[model samples]
Target chain A: MKAFAYVNATNEREVVAALKTDGIALPLAGGQDLLARMKDYIDSPDRIVNVKNALDTTVTSTPEGGLKIGAAVKIIDLYENQQVARMYPALNAAAIEIGTPQIRHQATVGGNINQRPRCWYYRNEEFVCYKKGGSRCFAVDGENQYHAIFGNDGPSHIVHPSSLAVPFAAYGARFRVLGPKGDREIAASDFFTMPTLASVLKENVLEDEEILTHVILPAPGNVRSGHYEVRYKASHDWPLAFTTVVLTMNGNRIGSARVVLGAVAPVPWRSKPAEAALAGKPLNEDTAMLAAEAAVSEAKPMSGNAYKVQMAKTAVKRAIMRAAGLKTV
Target chain B: MSDKEDRFGVSRRDFLKSAGVGGLATAVTSAGVTDVEAQAGPRVIGPGDVPVSLTVNGKRLELRIEPRVTLLDALRNRADLTGNKRVCDRGSCGACTMIVDGRTAYSCSTLAIDVQGKQIRTVEGLAGANTLHPVQQAFCDVDALMCGFCTPGFVVATVALLEKYPNATPEQARRELDGNICRCGTFVRIMEAAMKAKTVAGPPTRQARWGDMGVARG
Candidate 1:
């Protein structure tokens, strides 16, 4: 990595001020993503602001019976938090399935959500894809086995890499961003923007001078949620595709549903059709299969990723089954 | 040049101005002694070599290095502690796993300066002068290593696991050790060593810790 200055920020003000510098000043939380990108020369910032000590690291209960999780809370703590396990079990499941034990012990929630896409073309300095200021996405015509099947209408074909993002969207959480002017809350579903020709360099709506401070989850009332992931390697690998389902139950029938898919889109792919299929219908094997089929009905699979369509369907079906307390297999 | 100028011939005032730290500089220069820290912002350290202190194996080691130096590079290249090998420097492979503040972390992805005040433990700190740590001894007794490039990280990770869960279940052991990879396919033996070490290994006694060398003498 190239030489850079370090800033040991003590608070949010210092963090924003440090990043407001003339040179490129990036926040360093956990260093799981930023440091690796630096080593690969994908990013060469002049300053690194250490936010591990500066940001809030606790999970507190809001007056509205919701959770306000500080950005610096480690993934392990999020996974083991009893409140999260009870209230937002889909998020807890997603947290536990992240990278590995070592990664969970160090990586922070903010960093995980803000991590760059793991598209091999973007990671390798040689390819210089659209995410890297190049003309077009190499995954368009090149190897696209792990690329997106949904939301590929954009210039970039990279998948959003955060496992926590799907559940965050399903749980109706909002992200609080701290900036030089002030702080603002963005709905989790709207936080990630689809890639455009102009905004291909970034995945989320966070500005350079801002930091994501907290994730606020509204109270889950009368809801059952489940998250399921499919990966080639059971030990440690990114999921081929994953799904998180939040079903609002009205006695025996489903009142409403939120189905979100990951690794199949540039953003967390929310299937309105699947939600419509599940509404007012009793969750059974047949209904679950219908919802799964509806979830992938619009998937535009690439040359090499047609298999992911089936895997995504399986994940959606299993997520619904798991939410309903049924045998998925 | 005045004493305020850095080695790069840029005056501190100009440097601060160019770096957009004029506000912090004004605050630091104008604030009262009691109110200084409240007004002052984060202090910028190196784009050059700067002093960094680390507590490794219960001993403080100091070095002057550029801010980009990772903990793995600092320990292996500067502190002469090379037990933790750097195989995949991007934090995928766990060959550079180290225990920091009672948790196993990827040292390759961790900056040396950022971990200044944390207690760091590596594979080198596992044994004492007279006897090997129970985990190390178990690895040998079970023949859990073949090529051995990945052993130090596995040993460190295993020690952390056993320390956290004395009688770790098979699933727990698998999950904890999943970050590491062994090309020689020594996993069965390694798993056996981990289970055996759970029965034999206890917390390191006072005698089981190295005095100051930060390595086992044997």
Candidate 2:
């Protein structure tokens, strides 16, 4: 990695001031993703603001019976938090499936949501893909077995890499971002933006001077949620596709649903079609299959990643089954 | 500037020698840094070689290294502690696993300067001066290693697992050790060793140096 100055910022004001330097300055949270990217020379910044000490690292209950999770809260603590496990089990489930034990121990919630794409073309120094400020996307005609299927309409074919993002969107969370101008709350779904030619360099709406401070989850009332991920490896591998289904039930029937698919799109793919299919219908094996089919009906798979459509369908179906308290195996 | 020159306008070698190049030493009390500390502002380290103090295996070891150096590189290249191998270098492979504040972390992916005041337990610190740690002994007794490239990482991860869960179940062991990879396909033997080690594994020898820094549980 190229040499960079380090600031162990003691407060939020210090963090923002340190980032307001002449050159490229970035915040270092867990360093699980940023450090690796630095070593590969994918991102070379002049200064790094260590936010592990500066940011809040706690999970507190909100006045509305929701959760306000600090951006620096470790993934392990999020998984082990009893309140999260009881209230937002889908978030807990997604946290447990991330990377591995060591990664979960070190990776923070904000870092996980803000990690870069796992596209091999973008990561390798040789292939100058659109994400790397190049005009062409190598994954378009090149080896793209792990490329995105749903959100391939853009110049980049990389999938959003956060496992927690799907559940966060489903549970209606908002991200509190702090910047030089102060702080603002953005809905979790709006936090991640679809890749365009102009915005191909970044995946999120966060600016250079801004830091994601917290994820505020609204109270899950009369809802049953489930998260399921499909991976090529049972061990520490990125998901092929994943799904999180949050259903508001009226006795035995589904009143409404928030169905979100991950790793198949540039953003967390919220399937309004699947949500429509499940509305006013009892969540059973047949209805779950119907919703699953609707979830992948519009998937534009790449040349080599057509198999992910089926995996995404299965993920949606299994998530629905889990939410319905039915056997998925 | 010359290739040998530091950003601080001094020869790199001379700076190292003056800053106590050996991995263990005193905190940097440079005039510029002391002046910076006098201000009511956050202390910034360096793009140059700056003094960084790390508590490795309960012993405070200080080094004058660049802020970009990783924990794995610092321990292996500078501190002469090379038990933990760097295979994949990325966070994907668990070749450079270490326990930081009673939790397993990918040392290769963690910056050395970021982990200044934390308790860092590496693979080299696992065994006694003469005898092997129980986890290390179990790996040997069960023949869990073949090429032995990923052993140190596996041993460190296993020690962390047994420490966290003294009576680790089969599923727990599989989940905890899933981060590491062995090309020799000695997972069956490794599983046996982890299970056996659980019986003999004792309490954590030392208390965590810092008590949950910045973390407040709700």
Best by DockQ: 1
**Alpha-carbon error at A126 in model 2, in Å?**
1.1
Off by over 4 Å in 1: B1-39, B201-218
* Tens digit of per-residue lDDT, candidate 1, span A53-129: 88989999999999999999999999999999999999999998999999999999998888888999988866656
Show the lowest summed lDDT stretch of 10 residues, model 1 chain A: A126-135
Query: TM-scores, in order shown?
Result: 0.90, 0.89
Model 1 chain B: worst 10 consecutive residues (lDDT sum) = B20-29
Model 2 agreement with the true structure over A1-329: per-residue lDDT tens digits: 77888888887667766665555567888888888777776666667888889888999999999999998999999999999999999999999999999999999998899888888987775565666555678888899998889978978989999999899999999999876567889999998889887677678877546678899999999999988999889998999999999999999999999999999998999999999999999989899999999999999999999999999999999999999889999
Q: What TM-score does candidate 1 reach? A: 0.90
- Model 2 interface DockQ: 0.20
Provide the overall lDDT of each model, using Cα atoms, as 2-decimal numbers.
0.86, 0.84
lDDT of 2 by residue, B77-132 (tens): 99999999999999888989999999999999999988888999998888899988
